[model samples]
Target chain A: MLLGAWGIALFLAGWEVVGQTGALGMSCPPLSAVLAVLADPARALLFQRALGATLGAVATGYGLGLVFGVVAAAAGHLLPGMRGGLDRTSSVIHAIPSVALAPLLILSLGRQATPAALAGINTYFILYVATSSGLAGTSPVLRDLMSVLGAGRWMRFVRIDLPAALPTLVSGMRMAAPGALIGAIIGEWFGASRGVGVIILNAMQNFQIPLLWSMVLLTVMISLTLFWLLGAMQLGAARRYR
Target chain B: MPTAVRVAGVSKRFRLDGGADFLALDRVSVSIGAGEFVALLGPSGCGKSTLLRLVAALEEPSEGQVTVAGSAPGELARAHRLGVAFQDHALLPWLDVTANIGLPFRVAGRAVDRARVSALIGLVGLAGFEAAKPRQLSGGMRQRVAIARALVLRPDVLLLDEPFGALDAVTRRQMNIELQRIWSEQGTTTLLVTHDVREALFLADRIVVLSPRPGRVARELVVPFARPRDAAVMRTEAFHRLADELTDALGGGA
Candidate 1:
């Protein structure tokens, strides 16, 4: 664990040194410069507003997608005939590039709603796949026990299937966070009202390297933090469920 | 005597890969009187467990019928009258000992009977470990919890499929004695499936030996022992004699 942390620290130091040396052009600013831009009091409100909007979109999409995915997976599990159709539909939706779907989402839901909608779609696909497989992964021995105990379909699902699926479902949530974040950011690029994606895009075109790097670094930190939290949940579920 | 469980000419065939069927059991018939302890003894893969599975309603017979309490095996299960423990124990890892024992009550859509739960916990000697989860318990303790769960509902019939088959020799013997005591108290029409000859002789009122696969009932011996048989009985000459005879039957002897 210490080695991993040390490795990351060294990589960061190397990145800063490389940028400071001007070896990779102005696009690669020193880490200190990006931090300075992020911590600047003059630009505090601008960054805060963009971050707030982005966070709101990500949260909204992630929550909705989780609920939808879990419900759909449960429906498929209970109703066997629905399994095939739901699987194909989810695959089709996932296969359509989010980039290509962005303009269509913007057209239908408008700029303000586009980011959340895209994020939700991305989150939904990952969670659906995870939940379906997790539900199917119930142990054959446990299934026999359930049958012998007079457990009905609904009882079995509630008492065994759902709990058994939790660890895998948490893993899916861990995976979906970055996808949701990326989907929101990409959606914002296609005319969203305001977000970090807009700030990053503006900084890129205007050649404000530090601000661009600051946004990217902030995004990475948030993504990693969320992943870490969900990873803990996955481990907890695994310890209990398995 | 009233028949609590009746297995009449039941045969089971499992389909393997490539459309071939493996005959697991031939025509086998057995009947257990109410409150009797019957053990199906055979070598591993001799379909003794398959016969128990039929009684538990976990499998359908390819031919013939298995009736528990004068109806289909599933009916007894549907009424929550059947209790079972397998080699795997099948305790939900997420639930602690108390909740795992109380699972049958929840499954039956009835309120959790705290009094009965505590009684059975103590019955199986798991009193202080109620809050402990399955993973925290040792093999013997986990199987004890499984037995407690099986008995919590005061089930009409108890079916045990090699419940202590995975335990160490010392633990297995200790478990057998405890199980004999437990069975004596409830006197529930019980069917135990085991490959251990000593386990069968120690706990069963009657031992039904099966031949090698495809399994058929080879011999039956009435255990000539009184209720609540002691561990000392295992060291008896009669016990040794019966054990050898059953062991011979298991070795494919006619």
Candidate 2:
């Protein structure tokens, strides 16, 4: 609660300073003006629609990435030779900037949520590497113990490997959450009819500084909420393990 | 006497990358009788552990056959006839004490018997810690949990690879007593690999001493102590005599 209050205070203070100083060619809008726009129910509906669209794309992409990442990591152990090739390909994908690839994804998927999905493509690789390394990191002592106890391969994986890999997987998911949202917004910026990205683009084209600032605040709120949700999930899983 | 296990001309060779094959165990032969507690005493790298693994079916002998209960060790393991514990408490950290102890039964697709689990927990003196995770327990307690887990299925034969090797001296002594008590109660044929001569003497019905490098049996000493042996047995002349005999058999270096 204290952190939330500090965040609101800092944002308002920054808004006031930028508005008063008129720096950065600023016709900076005050916090009250943004809140007033938010209070307008009809305008609020537009923001809500944009928020919904962005969230939908992010959610879909993140879900797909998470499922595929875990499966790939588990399969990597069953097929050792494939691990190096898959890891190299994932690193290459990670190296490509998501923003630069947004246009290509849009072209391929015909300007739908494909670009956002592309933004989340790297998320799985991060999670896969983390999970696989975590699984591989089972101590030799522990491995010998299990083997001596007559635990089969499946038993070892279920009993030892999965629990050990969970923390890494959760951290990877937390890291990927923001990336998913950013990918969605970048997709919208490149080619989309709706979303905060589209709103910010329009505001810039018309030189509507106050509206652009409002849209930026909305994006920050959305991203923060998504990140907090993922963090909560991580905490819950950790608690369960404890 | 029915032999519970027979390791005839058993040898194990491990090949390193771009290196010559390293012989872990030479052509070794030993037979353990039913319901006997035999300790494999050797120095580090003597392949005592390798021999134990062969008995447990965790590894196959490179040159010879290892049979447990008249069948291959692997078959005995699959039939839930072999149980093992290691020096490291291999309890699943995610599982609580009870769940870990129940694992063998669970693996065999048998329903967990709460009464049996409670009995085993009581046998290990871990009565109130059923819900505690392995990470939450101390090293000794975690090892007790591992021992309980190994015994949960009530296997005919038990294999231990220095199961108390990681504990402090005092705790190791206490655990030795606990192990003897448990073994007497269970009456399962048992094989233990340990570097500690006192521990082997304290717990084993017979001690098998192995020489260093390409491990082979050097001596076999039968322990004539009575059941329910306590830490006080360590202070007896007979105990010291046996320890000296085993120590000399270990070539005064181990």
Q: Evaluated with TM-score, which candidate comes out highest?
A: 1
Predictions: Cα RMSD each? 1.3, 3.0
Which lDDT tens digits does candidate 1 get at residues A1-242? 99999999999899899889988987788888889999999999999999999999999999999999989999999999999999999999999998899889988989998889988999999999999999999999889888989999999999999999999999999999999999899989988778999998998899898999999999999999999999999899899899
Pairs of residues clashing in candidate 1: none
User: How would you encode candidate 2's per-residue C-alpha lDDT over B1-254 as one tens digit per residue?
Assistant: 69999999988999979798988888999889998999999988899999998887778789988888888788877676677888777777678999989887776768999999999999999998989988889989988988888888888888888988889998988888899889889988999999999999999989888998778888888998887788799999999998988888888545
In angstroms and one decimal each, the interface RMSD of every candidate reads 0.8, 2.8
Clashes of each: 0, 0
Per-residue lDDT value at B106 in model 2? 74
Question: How far does residue B133 in candidate 1 sit from its true spot (Å)?
Answer: 0.9
Each model's DockQ?
0.84, 0.40
Please give, for residues A49-102, the per-residue lDDT of candidate 2 as tens digits: 887888787878888888888888887865788888878877887788887777
**TM-score of A-chain in each prediction?**
0.98, 0.88
Which model scores highest in DockQ? 1
